[model samples]
Target: MKKKSLLVYGLSAMCLSFALPGPVAAVSNESCMECHSDDSLERDASTGHLASLFVDIEKFNASVHNFDEESCVGCHNAIEELDWDSDVPHPVDMPNPDCAECHDETVPAWAGSVHAEADITCYDCHNYHAPVQLAGRQTVAMMREAVWGKCHDAGASHDWLPQKEVHFRTGQCTVCHAPEDGSHVIFRLYDVTENRFLSCNEIMTGLQISGSFMANFDTDGDGVISPAEFQDFGEKLRERRFTTDIRAELN
Candidate 1:
């Protein structure tokens, strides 16, 4: 119990730290599209991206905000229109701000939240139009999608992004975060420890033999477990005569 409490506190603190956003980056999706839609933005678009594999343009277009003016560009980062010289193009460091940027009116509940601050971004936790389930609701299909995304997005995601299933399941991604800390970018490393008062062998063996949490304490409520009863339980587990077992013996 003490161990669990500490873990909980540490996690809470960690989460509080990211509940804020760093200064919003200055990258714009609108400016780049001026040159990109020309059908010859880059020689690499064909060979460089497997965008067709992960997300379909047609399906993505169905998102509630797909056509929302700056909204779509915020999430995709890919320039739909641009006037790049092709020889010296600006880098695409920031994609769209995810759904949160465009649909602030809808999910105001999550806007000033730590999830938003951590750069969990709009699409990271939500792919609204399709089968993707929102954070708290996961169906069998959603689980499959999450696992599939785990398998693929794991390699491509930013270093700070969480693209793993275990992190998703345990809610560890937001474990230490609170919605407020994410207003700005901040990194905090925390030291954590787990309780292990009983060894695994002891837990397994005790459970295997007794089938109850009470070893001699009459924990199972059979009624009447005394000093002798406790010792008897201990000795039986230790493989010795109950009376003499507590006296100590073999090295």
Candidate 2:
């Protein structure tokens, strides 16, 4: 009888750090993309899921690091050679870099955060591969999407959160659940007549507002509201009698 070869696989897992310099880049991104771009390329994760090998090049381009525009080897530092079809087990010692390697500045904030106590990594809330510039509801949407699969099922867990269904749809989990320090309270207009929160689209349709209301708070083009701006915005809402409630946002 011929001896059979045993197959083993290594799972890559690491907490992502921000703004950290990557390892000395050596390989071309093209070489790595050549194989990684294949949709057929997949590996069985220890969690019983088949992970796809496809990486969106467009999104990668938008990524904060863009793999430092150098090589995939910057992050995956253990590959001796690329063998798309080798029976050899993946090098188990592959170095999995952390986000802290680049983003030491945010480490203190993160360390003191509630997430840190729960062992949540930067990658828990942020995407390491497709780091897009997001704002306002976009960030909230991302958090909601992540919470469903990566964290917990909103409907199935913890009394389904305060205000139940209404709150879930109105605000991001972090808006209320994140630590109170450095938090900002944002008020979304509620349509008392309709018994619903007015979406930006609805507000535009109903009131014929010319520009995005999001810009109102993000005045000065800073992408975030200061205390003074927040106060002014609240005054404007009151003047308009928009009828709103506060949603806490971590700063």
**Whose TM-score is greatest here?**
2
Per-residue lDDT over 70-112 for candidate 1, one digit per residue giving the tens place of the 0 to 100 score: 3434555553444356654544444444454455674676666
Off by over 4 Å in 2: 1-25, 44-53, 67-71, 78-92, 112-120, 136-139, 146-150, 155-172, 186-251
Clashes of each: 36, 9
TM-score of 1: 0.27
Candidate number achieving the greatest lDDT relative to the actual structure: 2
Off by over 4 Å in 1: 1-55, 67-81, 88-98, 105-108, 111-119, 127-140, 143-251
lDDT of 1 at 84: 53
For candidate 1, the 10 contiguous residues with the lowest summed lDDT are 242-251
Encode model 2's per-residue lDDT on 1-251: one tens digit a residue. Answer: 12232221111112233345566435577777776677688877666899675777777787766845634665565764655476533463454556666678787779988789998877666766665555455344455664335666666774734567665655556555663434445556676766777776865555445676656566788776767787876676666676665544334
Pairs of residues clashing in candidate 2: 16-99, 17-98, 17-99, 17-100, 18-103, 19-102, 20-101, 20-102, 20-103
